[model samples]
Target: MQTQDRTNVSSVEAAIAASQNYLLSIQYPDGYWWVELESNVTMMAEVVLLHKVWGTDKTRPLHKAETYLRREQRSHGGWELFYGDGGNLSTSVEAYMALKLLGVPETDRAMKNARDFILERGGISKTRIFTKFHLALIGCYSWRGIPSIPPWIMLLPESFPFTIYEMSSWARSSTVPLLIVFDRKPVFITDPAITLDELYAEGAGNVKFELPRSSDWTDLFVILDDAFKLAENLNLVPFRQEGLKAAEKWVLERQEETGDWGGIIPAMLNSLLGLRCLDYDVADPIVERGLQALDRFAIETEDTYRMQPCVSPVWDTALVMRSLVDSGMTPNHPALVRGGEWLLDKQILDYGDWAVKNKQGKPGAWAFEFVNRFYPDVDDSAVVVMALNGVQLPNEKLKQAAIARTVAWIATMQCQGGGWAAFDLNNNADWLNLLPYADLKAMIDPNTADVTARVLEMLGSGNLSIDNHSLSRALDYLKNEQEPEGCWFGRWGVNYIYGTSGVLAALSLVAPQSHGNNIDRGAAWLVSCQNPDGGWGETCFSYDNPALKGQGNSTASQTAWAIIGLIAAGEGTGKFEKDAIDRGINYLLATQQSDGTWDEAYFTGTGFPGHFYLKYHLYQQHFPLTALGRYQAIFSK
Candidate 1:
């Protein structure tokens, strides 16, 4: 990370001043920083059902949630996953129902518009498997239409090809608890009279409501689901009782003392409902902790309340800390020191699920959320370790030891093809994506350029060059993965602009002389992608169509990514290539808000590519400062 030298330009200096101050003012007293992890209204919608299942809807403020849902409703009368996304079927259905549960009459204008959007899109039948799960539980949709995952899968050994361990951490955590629910198939009617009878395209009875079918692979899963349902109906399974016991044991053991299971809303909600199906009282200490953990995910305002898909204190703190350092904050400044200490305390000394497949690892990594010790993310761990390097911690010995452990763990966790996945080793089972139950199509975790390059960047920051075995192999993986257009595909981020920039930075930092050609090609691709407004942007649609890569209205975060990419590609120097860099810097200067912030509403972060997206509110603020600061470090006189 390069600290900026004070620049001659007044606007540049003033912009840095505003951003630094704005960041400092928001740090928590306990020394971490967090911003909202905003997804679509579906998170808010699911929380309404959570309240009803807990039987707390009458006590909790559904009206506040109503305000947030209405606020995000597009003029099309449907809610979207991100800004300017035409609309989505499942998201719209969830939002419409949540409002109705809040007492908004079906004939109300907002409800009418939402209902039209749902019916026009083929109604409840076409919604996703997970969405169908919610509707079925409330007695609106049929349990028969949903796909099944029999609990006996829990009994499969790790040696089995299709064991649960083959799935990603998020998928397994969600599926395990749901297995118990699948076995019991419990349906609780909070209000028996209210059903989604109005939203189905054909009348509820008239619609055949077939199980999901897409391909030959899906056909195989459909057959399995039907066979499982038949055996369940006959009570003929050999290990039925033992499978339930194993699943219950798994869910109970994974819960944190804080009530969080798997550090995601779906996992936590499923676990609670699964426990309820087994007849655990709401007053049980386990259920109480689960409720409290979810409550922690909710953000309330004067007139609004909404739930985050997950909390991001660990992820947010690492990014902000790193960007602040790169933007010229002192290494030992109080804020940085406190944040570094807080982060150090978060390192997992105990192994989680990742250890099941990884024997070379002891737990010395970090998770995305505060209490998710069971599932550490490779992306978050890399960023956090990098951020720690920039801070001048007082206990230098402790810091160095933790860094060494993290480095060793990261090195051994590389996948077979010289790439790295997010949470597990060698989880590139693409065949799983075709299952009828994989409607989200995000069941598997595969290696991509963004995560591989980020791993390289972390290794580089530790001063390990191409000489290291991991770096050499990963370089090959990244090179093979680059698109013909010179941009790499970004799996964790929006599209090519993000992947191109990240790879360029990693290449320049780690293997500049050896990989200079690759960096140059990527920089040129990023330059050609610049918008007329002197910034760059790529829509989420780019994931669906490669031709749309790096194409969209410019956003502050994407522009900063472009600017930083140019700098890291050795183009920020004023000897040449100043126009593009200067124009990019100027865009940041001109758009700077008076209060030392940048405002962006577009979603740049990816959850599952086209299926789910995130708008990191702080992306606009910190990324621009990091870009301008780097430009000043090189070009300022």
Candidate 2:
């Protein structure tokens, strides 16, 4: 057993060496880099795109990831949020497709297992909305069962309650291809392994296909059993033609000259596929340019390589910059200037979906990336302001303008109660969560503690309006949201610890004069929540299980978030905070591979609080820097 363990460790080391070299080559010329973003459905798109681009999918990482994914298949043969978990229908459908592309035969054990699971889970008839739509495209399911995304919504003025602009940033980007697909009803591929007869509902054959109408329910989405009723009528000739033209034009115009939508595989694939259905030739410049752009997102790491769904240079750079400055890296260091420039170049100058949806004047808000014009998130905006304030930009006018615009944007986004939502103001209705078959708990509106706290603190410190009556109402909401024990629940991050730390940090920035009152209370709560191992960790599962509160093995990343929060709350050198920081740094130091990175199988960030977690490759590096920087800058003295 000892010898086998040694062999396994050697193999991992070899693979890591190769992967590191490959990663190094892929770094952007600008000194920072990004990989594709991914989720269950989009992951498959990346797999297919990678295979097509590279002409061979044989890589050490691909094999390892494939093995992990297959091993994670549930007893019935489907994959979930984590590998070897129970199936999420959409994710399972995508995974099954990926395996097939990888040459897994229908009779293969993994494939058979997945098929059986799909059958038992009410078959494709009961699949989630997006899953059913994709299956219908390939003839595995019927198009009639899917809801419609009307192009007419585009024509709706910005003032309308349910304008397409009101959809989540993610939803709007996703909705574009959906609108195209809905209008054309393009079912281009049919799988012999699965068919409509194998999955459709009984006695539902021969019903004419209809599209789902759009509705805005500011209330909450609650699950309902009845089938979605078709809208009373359709606008036949003129409206249908108008919708079709708009859909086609939208798809073509948004095709990045490079062919990727923010360099994501699914959006690129679906849009290109729709264009093909419209008779665009494969050799057309639109298609050719897209293919070239998609190729750039792939990284050939060590023994294997895969495409990242999108780049995250700005996001990673911003966080790392803070970590360095906080860690005691002098402000004059060249790294700070290079990183600050990258961030300065990332701010959105034009109005985005926020402008259309909220009818707010076009104020600057930083988005996740440059080209994602749909929704400029409030959290990113708040953090950008904080990051910008840390480094001095050479251009004085530009710096002042950025500060003023960011301040204005954040102040407007603050809810009537003083907190901020992720994407919009006054849009946190739970009704979106009740999309009958959708299992995502994160689809609801964002009161998101971390985001709200960050916004309050950023605006408050600078003589901004984050302290207005509306801002105070937000603070009251945060206070009430806090558990009697003093911890608040994190909506976009992990569990109670994330919320507790965020609230502490924001309250400190707001009430710094109170000097350790709210800060002390928040600090006490965090100290109490610290695990015996001295580092902080919270499982994504904690969202579903309050009893599992603060229950996770020690991790460097969460420990850093917690430690930073505590320090920001004025507890920098407190016993528990210091202990947590020391242990977390030690954990990171011990785990660092020779390549100056750490591999954590546990996902520390949340996209959907109860349903999905993100594996941020840079978190282990940047976060440790932040925590360590804080220790050096303050405690070392």
Candidate 3:
């Protein structure tokens, strides 16, 4: 028994070392790590349609994009928003249309299957509103079918109830330019041959377009939408001129020096479309720089090409740096110092959109992307501060200064219920979602368990405690949020396991002995959900069906999350918890590839819950390392 225990220790230590070396080797000289944030084919499908709209289809490597789209097609012939999910109507429409534009024949096997699948699901008319918007730009879909987003909203005073400032930061940035495009309703005529006429099931002329009436408020908004369209057809909008000017100016001014907007693809692509509507010369510097920025988001290889939903160098670096240090890398190692120093330089000292609501909060913290200065989110800011906690930097004062203001800034961002959101402070106007244009239901930044738990973890890692004045209410929030079965909801990750792990970790650090009950219940729930194979998993379907929580095929990241959660809940003393942790750690060890990475084909990251998902290419890399390192720290002691 003693020899076996010794072997286990040696194995854990060896796994940690291999992961550390692998991550260290990949660190850029300037000090950061990044990888693709894969979402779905629609991202690249839009890229194809965007170039075709602007007549630059020949300029980019469209063939490479075509290759990627074909590779992602499901066995049934349509595309999905994430892996292993059935075909999504909107995604399939976009991919089919894009493939046709790239000259795929209707008679081809791939095209026939996609067309059959789409038509079986009610054709293009059944697709989402966003896909309709993309089709409208190329004249394949009617502008009349598209929902109205009055540009006049841009001219409203900030104090008004419906001002742009009320929307979430990402929604606001992406929508302002869209307001201009919706008003102009421009259609750049595409090649006569490049039409989606055959994809419309009801025939393009006969399809009825309607907004979903999920509530009485939405029903009223749908009627109002008709009124707005009638007014639009009559050119009766009062502030159309002023509205256009304000929106155009807002879009241009918000473009970062790096030429991206909102640091995401939607904003970048829509800004390009907005510029086209305004008659900007294609060769203009702003247009050229924006083009270059979008080009940088694309990753091409010998056979396939794809675009990331967004880049995450700062987010990835902060997490990876912390994971490496936790794995026993020396605090002052060159990798840690360089990565820490690089993060210090990325701090946003100037005010951003969050400042509009959190006026008392000073600007300090980092954003997920390389240069999205206007939107530094609380989630990323918290993790980055925690990541820098013990790292030794040459300019120690600089690190302290950044963390202090960040801590202060994060404090002021607490919502009404003592929870934190990613971007805005108290951005919980749920009624805004009733608007027809908010079909995605992502207009408001509501406080979520995953984010609040992460915030608590950051607080617990520092001077704050459960009884601290700043966190007493937050602790209550977490306590009340626990489900009857003991798991918590993960609004930003896959269902229950992610939320439970984060909350248990926070409780382990911040809660006193009196709080052990909450920890035990959560830890027990996690133990009960373990798969027969000894790992843990959850499906995105849980967002749509609560009963499905903590059920799916196990993957590297989710299993690591469960292990980290159990350890945080004091697993070592309990036979059940200890065995569960042992099995999980062993699963990670057995599944890790020879290159010190794990292959995760399933997406553990969440975009908009059920509607969208993401597979962070590095989630398989950094998370397991953190799990193993933290486990060694506790049991090996």
Among these predictions, the greatest lDDT belongs to: 3
**Per model, how many backbone clashes are there?**
0, 31, 0
Residue 228 of model 2: what lDDT?
Answer: 21
Model 3, span 21-121: residue lDDT tens: 88989999999898888899888999888888777778889899889999989999899887788888899999998888888989989999999999999
The better candidate by TM-score, 2 or 3, is 3
lDDT of 1 by residue, 1-637 (tens): 2343233366787888899999999999989999898899988888798778778777677789999999889888899988899899999999987887777888899989999998999999889988889888778887888777777888999888888888888899988888888777777877423678999898777876568666655587788878877887898876878888999999999999899999988898889889888999888999989988888999988999999998889988998998889888999999999999999999988889888889888889999988888998888989998999999999989998888888778877899888888999888888888777887888988777888888888877767433467778898888888888888888887879888988887887777877777887788888888888898899999988888989998889999998888888874221234678788888888888889998877999999987999888888988898897887777775
**Candidate 1 clashing pairs?**
none
RMSD of each: 2.6, 7.4, 1.8
lDDT of predicted model 1:
0.85
| Model 2: per-residue Cα lDDT over 1-637, one tens digit each | 4785455344434433443344444455674445444344345434553343333344324554455457556776677774323557666766676566555677788877777776677655555576666656656566665654555666666556665554555555556666666666665542223343433334246333433323645212321221222331343323555666776786776665446663345576666656655777657888667666655655654444455555566666666666555545566556566666676777777665566445665657776654555456787777767776777666647866887888877777766545678877666545555553244534445556778887776765455564467666767777767776767788766768778777876777675554345566677777777777667777777877888777787676777777777777664323345565555545555555666555666667677666665666777666655655554454544
Candidate 2 regions exceeding 4 Å error are 1-42, 45-78, 83-89, 116-126, 190-238, 250-270, 273-277, 291-293, 301-307, 436-445, 460-467, 513-518, 572-596
How does each model score on TM-score? Answer: 0.97, 0.79, 0.97
Regions of candidate 1 where Cα sits further than 4 Å from its true position: 1-8, 215-217, 465-467, 571-576
Q: How high is the lDDT of residue 506 in model 1?
A: 85
Give me candidate 1's TM-score against the actual structure: 0.97
